[model samples]
Target: MAEYEALIIGLEMLVELGIQYVEILGDSMHVLKQIAGEYKCLSLSLAVYPVAARNLLTEFREATWEHIPREENFAANELAQVATSIQMPEDCVQRIIKIGKKSLPSILTTGMEIDVNSAAITEDDWRNPIMTYL
Candidate 1:
């Protein structure tokens, strides 16, 4: 079973239907995470999938990515497996997207290599919380 083929095909249809951002949750961390933009997929061919996947993102004015646990993606993976086993046509699998939800802005932001908790937003900046009222 290929990875991008499913994601790209599904996303393409969504894009045509006016979908903006897309959140794909799954254990196929390899594909789901990368396409979600949570991680970089550095390959010339993969990157060239098409601007169509990107252009739709612009319609929303922004795009982002995140990774959710495998449990959340259970249904999709099951259906995908069925599709692959049957060698169903691409159009048939596209129907699975009907269950997809409108993409939301990823709440989990990417972390920095070094996340030192500076006094940037700490209470220690002041003697006491009440003192700030002064």
Candidate 2:
């Protein structure tokens, strides 16, 4: 679950940075297959993530996902392990990204952070809202 969430978050971050192409490599064959539309996600919460991920993938002009052996996935494996091992502080307000809903763009435009309430997201960036209930 964490790996899937991390993958989605990473893809969202890349899109926010205006990256137009991506090649995703992962050790989890199931996740790779799900993203590639070769496997069906069985869990509800988990299912939403892949939908969100695929939507984000559309932002890229080119995107590919591949599975690799766990032993060969060195950097990403280490990062995932480290991320899961850390304990969050109580004061840390973890933002929940509703599945299939575009995540708030992390990058500031023109050296200024746009206020969520004030910023007007154009149709070019805003697509269908997939997580209205959340």
What are the per-model C-alpha RMSD values against the true structure? 15.2, 14.5
Best by lDDT: 2
Q: Record all residue pairs in model 1 with backbone atoms less than 3 Å apart, i.e. clashing.
A: none
- List the candidates' TM-scores in order: 0.38, 0.57
The Cα local distance difference test for each model comes to 0.49, 0.70
Query: Candidate 2 has what TM-score?
Result: 0.57
Q: Write the per-residue lDDT of candidate 1 for residues 4-123, one digit (tens) a residue.
A: 545555655666677766665445666655545566545534553323334334555345545556678677768869866764576674533334442322111212122223234366
lDDT of 2 by residue, 62-108 (tens): 99888889899898868869866876679989956343444333221
